[model samples]
Target: MKTAPARPEAAPAPAPPVRRARARRLLMCRPTTFEVSYAINPWMDPAVPVDAALATAQWERLYRLYLALGHQVELIEALPGLPDMVYAANGATVVDGKVLGARFRNAERAAEGAAYLDWFRAHGFTEIHDPLHINEGEGDLLTCDSFILAGWGFRTAPEAHREVEAVFGRPVIPLELVDPRFYHLDTALAVLDGDEIMYHPEAFEPRSRALLRRLFPDALLADRADAEAFGLNAMSDGLNVVLPRAAEGLARQLAERGFNPIGVDLSELLKGGGNVKCCTLELRAPALGQ
Candidate 1:
């Protein structure tokens, strides 16, 4: 009888939007000796002077910001002669504590790669995969929600993708980059969440661009302007995103989605062809039951 009033059917609860868990633990290197002594990518111009003190100060601000956000910031000691070492994302990629060492393509950065691998080994990444093929670490390899996205036709070799799949025990989707500007995958695309991606199509080949659309049907399309400012090279911690000061469009877009965008001036490091994501590496830990 108490149930006789059969409470009006409760409204069905709205389904939660699918999202990739935000990264909290990250790896970063101090720009103790960063400078643009040589040009590796298009964005790097040796003629353009870089202020080492300014770069160090900017990087300090970023590191402090990550800490202020309650993120675990790991470090690899800053060594002399490794001017580009500040772009820690390029050193190596960590997937569930499994380290995939970088086999850098250029000799100038070769030592930097080895230094990173050494640090990983000394720091408890036991399952280190010394690369058999040249791969530029997280700059080209990114762990999207259920799978890994590999970028080639630039720094990382296609062969490396297969090795990554075998090592990580996950499906690896290879996307080819066509433009030199977006030399690294991190420079062209940012995984906003599990199902949402932000990218600039001009950086990718038509096939890869089409594949991105098919894979992420609701991807956010970005323009060359955004790419120029390295908008896609942003680091997200679920609720907040750290991006370049010049990426106003990306900041607004993220703000509309309820994300707090923290912009920083990484222009000094940009002389070596990198930005926010470039300085940060998300080191994922092992999943439960591992």
Candidate 2:
């Protein structure tokens, strides 16, 4: 009998694309114990100086807001009396078992990277990387389960976006910010639940606006007055939101819609050029199969 023919070997299956795990634990800096500045803009002269009394009160309010939202807030030790280094949330984004520390384009804030690196290592985040030539941070990025939208212009550089794409092994949708007044993406755009987004049209170019509309067709265009008043593009947890106390009406509306709004009075912090989302960093969620 003839020997049986050798069976054809099956080709190895292609590797599955990596999926970012859902964020569960977040890192937020405590303003009560930290020295921060709010003299971010003089041209606009729009922000109020944060005295000790005002800063204390605002910290209390922000702390309460975070607690009410049910997040396990880890207050990192204040950075060695660095008054201007307290804006921690603008430093990084954690996803898919990796930490992408920010490369701040602003020379005034370049020290932010070192501060964040210490925090990341202290928290046991080993997989970390950043762009060599450009500065980028969470302020320029909006990450979902599927993709990351990177805003490039005043705050985040084009080279930084490319670095993010390379590290995450995913596409980084580039958006050009037209208005310098907005400063960062978080100042003018926010991705709410589902495909709904909240934005200020004036902050973006016509091309960027068109792209945003296409990406989030159901986006809610908030009045510029409301957006500006409340820091509408600030950070959110999907289930809850932290906003300026002045946004009482918006908070109520969100509450009625099944979202828990934790309103914090960040007038002092905003004076320094940031709000709730600007002062904390969310670490990566535990990877699947962990």
Candidate 2 Cα outliers beyond 4 Å, as residue runs = 1-23, 32-48, 252-257
Candidate with top TM-score is 1
In candidate 2, clashing pairs total 5
How well is each residue in 39-131 modelled by candidate 1, as lDDT tens digits? 879988888878888888989999999989889999988789888889999998888778888988888898988899898888877898888
- Give residue 159's lDDT in candidate 2 (0 to 100): 75
All candidates: CA RMSD in angstroms?
Answer: 6.0, 13.3
Q: What digit string (tens of lDDT, one per residue) describes model 2 on residues 1-290?
A: 89999999999865533322223466666554343432343312423344767765776677665665566567665565555454566777777778788776656567667787787888777788755745556777877655687887787788777788877776888888876667777777776554445777788888988988887775656566656764564556766666776766666655655566666677766666667666656665655885
Give the local distance difference test score of model 2: 0.66
- In Å, residue 10's CA in model 1 sits off its true spot by 25
